[model samples]
Target chain A: MHAVRNIRLCTKDCLCLYVCPTGATDTETGQIDASKCLSGCRACVDACPSHAISLIPAEFPPQQEKTVSVKNALLTLAASKMDQEEIASKLAETTGNPVLRQLAEALGKSNRLMAEDMLRESGYMLPQSRTVGELLESLLSEKQPADFPEAAVKRLLELVNGNTMQEGKASAFEKIDY
Target chain B: MMRKFVCGICGFVYDESLGYPEGGIAPGLKWEDLPEDWICPLCGATKVEFKEQETVIPEEKKQSSLDEEHQEKIRELSFKELSALCSNLSKGCEKQYRNEEADLFRQLAEYYDSKSSAAFEAQISDLAALIEADLSSGYENANRRAAAVSDRGALRALTWGEKVTRILSSLLSRYEKQGETLLANTNVYVCEICGFVYIGDEAPEICPVCKVPNLKIAQIQRG
Candidate 1:
């Protein structure tokens, strides 16, 4: 494990610079150099006042398995949420009243959040999971809207699949059904 | 009568009435009058990346959230729903590791759960079928509808949510197909903002969904 810094959360206390033995923590860039970082050492992790620094493992465990029942339940919940989102979206569009629109937006957001929770529980939230790569690929195959953030999604797929597995191994995961 | 144009990339709106004064374009200049080379100040997206949009300034709309229908809807929430909501709230708190508050919400959930006589019924089975019909198709429909409406924020939310959710679904499928061997030596990191998961030894410098910097993504250390 190596210590990493959250630049946004960093208060610039510079305690990590003092606590780090290998000079891995840099205040100027607000980044911790992983190469110099000593494995299992948590000097910066403990010293940071803002709780910005954390240790990340060099290896990760496989995703926990989900039962078929649980998976179906989550999908069902997500489907209902999408329905609610549709209703809220219509209300937001048709309403001449701003207050109603705002309420509709809030309702839509809450439903989306709940749906996300259920989906997360059902094993869809993790970026590292191969299932995520498949999802991105599928989206790419479909014709996106003019304003769709295609580049960001593509960049995300690279970041998700780029670091791990060699080119050949990674390609094996891309099973395009559509 | 001034028009608004939004960046296809970052959703930054360029108004004809306020023509990017900071970028040397003066007020009263129409978007057509601007140079072809001009780009979005926020994300540097090119001129071709902008699309015409309707004005949606909220303050210009009427104030107050006290709609009678909304009140009626809130009143209609049942004990079971309340229990589930409280339980979800408790889980959200727990994810942040806020133990005391999580306990409070969990206690509230139990209180509501106790008042509700029957347990929540198991409503679904056959995960594959639901994923295809509900999640996959459902997302496409929502995305299409949201796009047609042309609400930038709503469209972005749906887009991001669908992308992230699809990723999760793919990962789940992989886990189901390959099992533990797929995770033999990789490390997983999760974006705290948008919940994008990373399987590498280090997290990405920026989150794909919310575009938050690396500092917001944390490693998931399983004990």
Candidate 2:
């Protein structure tokens, strides 16, 4: 854990500068230096008069997974927001009234933000995390349609194995439908 | 006599079944009976800016069995097919000047491919090789498409997407180090509107991230 300062609440008492053993709290940016600060040390956090400093863990716990139903609902709402954003964008472009156009611009931005938030919540925003990796693996082993892209899978495997340089040769996998 | 009106500016719905009690509007109030000067609580838009929208009652929400079947159809696609679909979708987004969304779709495509490789790491993975080629080609296409269009709104959205992706990536790294044992002990709740996660015994009265009421927070079960 490292102590971070909330500059808004920081009183500039400089108490943290005195308490911090590694001078991590004495940074010019008013933020904690995670690398310099010792692990689990909360000396500055305890000494801060304004309570602006708090210890944040280096590692965060895993986020819980949403059920399929909840995911579907969120995705549906995201699609609706995307539609609203597109309409607002068009209004902003074509509206004759300046005031109405400004309002439309604001609405377009707001709708986009809302849609992105929903997408983040739906797990698409996450990178290749371990949980997602496991889920993907499970999906791949299952039965697939006749037109499933087997060549794509083969190419992906070669890339992961660091054999991308030898991918020019066409293989029989591309000819197979199943 | 209950009617629904949606604010054109912010999509805030004014349903007479649940009137704006905070604004002193009583339940069962007709849309026409609303004070002509009344503005949308969300975006301050006047009544003239409100449009009548189709209201889905609670009972009608139950009649979405067809939607469920549609979802099942999507779920039926194999991982390889899904990755291909995601890659194609990313290319489509790139062409539309949605750089941020395009990046996200690309990340998802990479993720699905990574999973396949991880699952069959001992074997010669054909999927991994294909995804590698696609990744390089996809980036080249996205870069070319982004240079052709210059929309401020798209640029702003792209910035926001990058910020969100960075935060989520940090969280993922943290979780990887902490493991599931630590997470199992904490109670986790997800925001229904924004999907923000909160860890605690009780949900916050208001979501600090989105400012939504705690009524939307739903607890997830730990394995």
Candidate 3:
């Protein structure tokens, strides 16, 4: 495992800089030098005040399996959440009252949140899960709504099937290897 | 000619025009006409339980919907409530991967906690019970009021909130059954767009729900 900084949470406490024995933490770039960071050493993890830094395993465990019943239940919940989100967005767009519009926006955002949770629980949101590819394929086959995020999904499918690691930023294991 | 009298103990209003049908009392029966043996159906209080109630006009029902006693109950914000609100805001920020904002909110929560003057520390389960009650009836009341005034935005928010809460409640029950096993070995990733949580070695190329790009997704580093 190696420590990574969530830049958003790093409040510039600079405790990580002082505590890192290898001087791996760079405040300028806000990226930890994985090569210099000792695996399993959590000095900065404990010292940081904002708790923005955490350990990520060099190798991730495989995806967990779900039952058929759980999958069905999740899909049903997702469908309803989607419908609610759409309705909320429409209401927000048409409403003239500022408070009402904000309320509608919050509702739409919350519905999306719940729907995502359901999808994650059902094994559709994980890149390593085989169900992801299958779901993408099915979505491609179906007649989706005009606003459906087809292009993004297609790009994601390509990335998932090809290089799981992102460019410019290598996996933690790869960075530590060098 | 009929008036309503509420049970002080249970908030069960006894309307003379619509007498407790299920309780075997017929419509148009005056409170004085009913036998003294008739008790509060909800709390089994005696007829004397009606002493605190006044003659409530039907049309002005909305004005008295939240009585003085209830208003007083919510008048002051307890330390626990503030802490809970800050904690909730922190969690919301965490979901959006706004780690800095989340940390700030968490600090606020801790500040509230340090200043908490309650005789006892609040239990999370007790908070859960309050949330359950709110999900069950609070949104419904708000929706009814919004519908009355034809407020489309408020109505939409209430409708979505109620439906999502119900769905989440069911999902939570299922999670309670085997959440540990379900989350045994996988890493959890959350999409910044729709707040979709992904469990894997890494985030999905795209959020299945919101279809946001990989750059927008981030792993949850629990604090």
Task: Judge candidate 2 at residue B97 and give its lDDT.
Answer: 34
Candidate 2's displacement at residue B120, Å, is 45
Query: Least accurate stretch of 10 residues (summed lDDT) in model 3 chain B?
Result: B68-77
**Model 2 residue A153 CA deviation in Å:** 19
lDDT of 2 by residue, A47-161 (tens): 9889988765432333334445444443444444444445555666666655434434544444445555544444433222233334445545868566554444443332222
Q: Which digits, one per residue and each the tens of the lDDT, describe model 1 over residues B95-164?
A: 4333464565466556654554442322112333444454556655444433443434344555555545
* Clash numbers, per candidate: 11, 20, 2
| DockQ for candidate 1 | 0.02
Q: Candidate 3 DockQ score?
A: 0.03
DockQ scores of the candidates? 0.02, 0.02, 0.03
Candidate 1: what's its TM-score on chain B?
Answer: 0.46
Per-model TM values vs. the true structure:
0.38, 0.41, 0.39
Candidate 1, residue B35: CA error in Å? 64
RMSD of 3: 23.0
Compare the candidates by lDDT and give the number of the best one.
Answer: 1
- Model 3 pairs in collision: A8-B100, A9-B100
For all candidates in order, the CA lDDT equals 0.55, 0.50, 0.54
Query: Comparing candidate 1 with candidate 2, which one achieves the higher lDDT?
Result: 1
Q: Which candidate wins on TM-score? A: 2
